[model samples]
Target: MTSSFAPDSLVLNRKLPLWYQVSQSLRASILGRSPDASLRLPTEEQLAGHFGVSVLTMRQALKELEEEGLITRHRRRGTFIDPAARRASPVRLLGSIDAIVAQQSGEHTTILGHGPEPVPGDLAAYFPQCPQVVTYRRLRRDGENGEPTNWAHNTVRPEVAERIDLADLERWPMTKVLRDAVGVDIGRITDTVEARLADPVTAELLQVPLLSPILHYTGIAYDGAGQVVDVARIHYRGDRFAFSVTVEAR
Candidate 1:
C-alpha cells in the first residue's frame, strides 16, 4: 500500500545531523496523525526517498523511534505506529510569544531557586549595561503524571524583578508576571531554538540520560521602550517535547 507521507513537507536542515533531523520530522508527523494500530508507515526505502536520505540514515532514524516506543517493526510485516503513542503526550512547542506563554501556564511549576545573581557572561549581550540580574530557576512537570518536562533559568533586570511577587512565579509564567504584576510594557519577544546535548546538571535535574538530545530555547523579552527586560534559558526533555511552526503563503 502506498503511504500518504508528504515529501515536500520534510525540509532538511543541512547543518544538523541528517539522521537526527529526519527522525525528528518523522516523529512529529507520526504523532500528529490519529493513533491507529493498523496504520502502516512507508517502507524504509520509500521513507528514505521521501526524506532524500540514504537508507542507512533512515534506518538510524527509525531505530531511535523504536527505542522511544513510538513504533514497532516486524520482519516482512512492515512497521506500525504504536498504539501507546497517544500516551506519550509530547509538548507542541509553538512559535508565537503569546502561544509560548500560554503553553507553560497550564504546566505544574516548581521553583528551584530564585535570587539576585550576576548575569552569565554569555548572556551579557542581552542584558546590556546591567551588572546583576535576578535569577530564577524552575522545573516544569506534566500536570497529570508529574513527569519532568522542562527546566528554565530566567534572568531579569533587578528593578523589574523587585516589582514582581515571588509567590506569583509558582503560578504564572514570567511573561505574565512581568506584564501584569511588574507593569512592564512588553513590546516584543525574540526566541531562538536549537538542539543540544544535555549537560550533567541538566540531565540530573530533568532525570534524563547525560548527553541525550534536548531542546534548548533562549528567549529575550523587550519592553515597549526597547529595553531588554528578561532573558530565559530553557531546556526541554527531547522525548517529552517537539517544536512546531506554521507558515502561511502570502
Candidate 2:
C-alpha cells in the first residue's frame, strides 16, 4: 500500500502499514489538532493499541517523529508532543547571558579565547553589506574546574570591535562590553537552536566522545533598520544544559 503521510493534510485512515500509517496520523494531529502545549503525550503501548501496531514498530515510528522534533520523551513520563512552536513564537532576546548565568545557583564560568576573526559565510549572509567583522570565541566552563560547557563564538560589526579586549575578557562577557564600552543599545535579538551530534572540533573541546550529542544555539542581534549587528553560535554541553520554553496564546 502507498504511504499515507501528508505533510500538512489530515488522514482518513485506509489500507496502510500500521506503524508507517500511525506516523503520518500523528504528524497530522500535531499540525491540525493543536494538542495542549503543556500536556504529556500518551504512552507507547497505549498508542500501539490505539493504532493496531506492535509495540516495537510503534517505537520505531516514535523515534522518527522525535528526530523531526515532533515529540519528546522523558525518563519515566510518557512521550510528549513539542507544542512550543505551534503554541507561540519562541523566545528571542538579547539578555540571554545574564538570563542564563543568573539562573545558576553557583559561580559558573571561565572564559577562554576572545579575538577578531572573519565571520563564516553562513553567518555573514545575515549581515548587511559590511567590511570586516570581529568575533569572540570563548570556552565557557560551567563550574570551578568543570568540563568545558560551550564554545561561544560571537561575531559583531566593526564599529563594536574596540570594545573587546582579550586581556580583560577573562573577567567579562563581550555582550556587556558592547553596551558598556561601544555605546550601542541592544534593543532586539533572535536565537535559533538545534540538537545534533558534536562535530570533531566540538567533541574535543567539550571533552565528549565522538558522535556524542550536543545542543547548538545560534543567534543574531539586529539594528533598528534591520542590519545584522551580530551572529553567534553556542555549543552547549547537553548533560548540563537544559533548553526549555513556555508557550501562551497571543
Candidate 3:
C-alpha cells in the first residue's frame, strides 16, 4: 500500500520515506499553528492509525521532531511543541551579556578550553586585590548550519571558578553560573564595543580569514555589594551582529 502521510513542504521533496514525510508535515503544522493553541500533538498510536502506518513508523517520525528541537516527548505526558523553538529570533541587544545569549535560544555553545590564569594588569584594576582567576573560552555556533558566530573568554575568581563545571557553562551564561554557584548577584555591567581586525587564533576559531573585521567587546560585571564577579571579552563576526541603543532628549 502507498504511504498516506502528507508531504512536508519544508523538506522540498515528495518521494522521501514515509516516516520523513509524516515528520515534515507534522513539524510544519506545529510551527504554523496559532501561538495560543494547544502545543501538544496526538499520541503515536492515533497518529499511526491516521496515516495508515505502524506505531513504529509514527515513533520514528516523532523522534525526528524531538531531535530538531521542534517538539519534546515526555515519558507519560505526551509530546508538546518546544516554546523556545518558536521564540528564537536573530540575536538583538536586549540587555546584559546573559540576556543577549538567552535571547537566541537556537544557538549552541561549546567550551573550547578552561583553566586558571593570572589576572592581567588592566583587568586587575577591576578585581583590585585578587591576583589570579580562572578563564573559560567558548565558541557559539549556529544551531542549524553549525557555523561559528562568536567566541567569548570569561574570567572569574577561583572560588566562583571552582563552582563552575564545563557542563554548567554549556547550559547557562557565566553571569548566571556565578549566581547559581556562589550567590553572586550582578549589580552593573559595563560594556565597551570596538572594531578590530581578527587575530590568527580568533580567525581560526571563528573560521574567518586573518584580518577580517570583528566586533570586540570588553565587559566587567560587578556584584550587588560592588565586588567583581567576572570579566569577559567577546568577539563576534562583524557581519552577523548589530548593536542598538536608546537615548532620551536633553
Candidate 4:
C-alpha cells in the first residue's frame, strides 16, 4: 500500500545471510508503523522488485515475519499486518558508531585498567607490524540504576595510544577519543556482533551468571590511510541490550 518505498536505501550486509538480514529489516519497518497505518503489504513480486532480491528470498523473509506473528498472509487476499504488531515492544535501532556512542552518553564509565600489553591473538592480523598495544579496559553502568551493563577491552596502536590521556578514557568512547583527541582520521569501522556464553572474567565483570548468554561485539577501526588504528572487544549483558538496525525505505 505504500508507494514511497525506496529500495535503494536498504543496505544489506553480505556477511550475514541475505534472507535473515532482509527479514530483520522488514521486521523493523513493520513494527515501526503506526497503528492507524495501512496494514496491507505489497505483493511478493513487488516487494522482491523493491528489495532487489528474488521472489523466493522475499517470501522467505515474509515467512519469518509470519512466524513471528507480525504479519498474516491469506492465499489471495495478500499480506496484512497483524493487529498484535502495534502492541509489540519498540526496538532501538542504531545504524552508526556515532549513534551507538550517543545511546550510551549517559552511562557512567569506570576505568578498570590500562597498560602496554601484547597484541591479542585474535587481533594480531589487524596489527601485523606491531608487537604490542596499549590495552584499555573499562566498565559502563546505567546512569539511572548504576547497574553494570557492559565491559570493553580496547587495544590501540602504540603511537595512537601515546596521544590519549587516561582521563579521557572515562569520558569518551574510544572511537571519539581516537578521532577527536588523537587526531586520527578514521575512515571505516567494521563491526561484528554475536552471542556467546560468558566466561568467568566476563561473568564477574558484567555481574551475570557463568555460562549466561552475552553479546560479543568486535570492532576494527582503520585510519584514512587504511592502517588499523584500534581494535575493540566488548561484552554486553544480553538482558540489558538489544542490537537493531533500521532499513529506511527513503
Measured by TM-score, the strongest candidate is 1
| Model 4 RMSD, rounded to 1 decimal | 9.8
Q: Give model 4's clash tally.
A: 0
Q: Candidate 4, which segments miss by more than 4 Å at Cα?
A: 1-95, 103-106
lDDT of 3 by residue, 1-250 (tens): 2222232243224455777766755764554454456666778887787766689988998998898788888999988778765531233454665674464333688888998888978788877778789899888888735878788898888877776777877876676676665577778877777867689989999986566557787778888888887888888775455454545465
Candidate 4 clash pair list: none
Q: Which candidate number would show the highest lDDT if scored against the true structure?
A: 1
| Model 2 lDDT tens row, 68-187 | 787888888778767652431122233555653232222344455556666567765775476577777777675668757677777888776775566545555555555555666666
Candidate 4 per-residue lDDT, tens place, 1-250, comes to: 4343222236666766667767766765665554456778889998887777899999998998898788899999999878667432222335676865564343688889999998889889899989999999999887735878888999999999999987777898888888878899988887778877689999998886666557788888899999999888888776555566678888
Instruction: Let me know the TM-score candidate 3 reaches against the reference structure.
Output: 0.59
Cα shift from native, residue 140, model 1 (Å)? 1.1
**Candidates sorted on lDDT, descending:** 1, 4, 3, 2
Tell me how many clashing residue pairs each candidate has: 0, 0, 0, 0
Question: By descending TM-score, how would the candidates be arranged?
Answer: 1, 4, 3, 2
lDDT of 1: 0.79
Using all chains and alpha carbons, the TM-scores for the candidates as numbered come to 0.72, 0.55, 0.59, 0.62
Question: Which has the better lDDT: candidate 1, or candidate 3?
Answer: 1
Q: RMSD, each candidate, Å?
A: 4.8, 10.3, 14.2, 9.8
Greater lDDT among 2 and 3 belongs to: 3
lDDT (C-alpha) at residue 131 in model 4 = 95
For each candidate, the alpha-carbon lDDT, in order, equals 0.79, 0.61, 0.71, 0.76
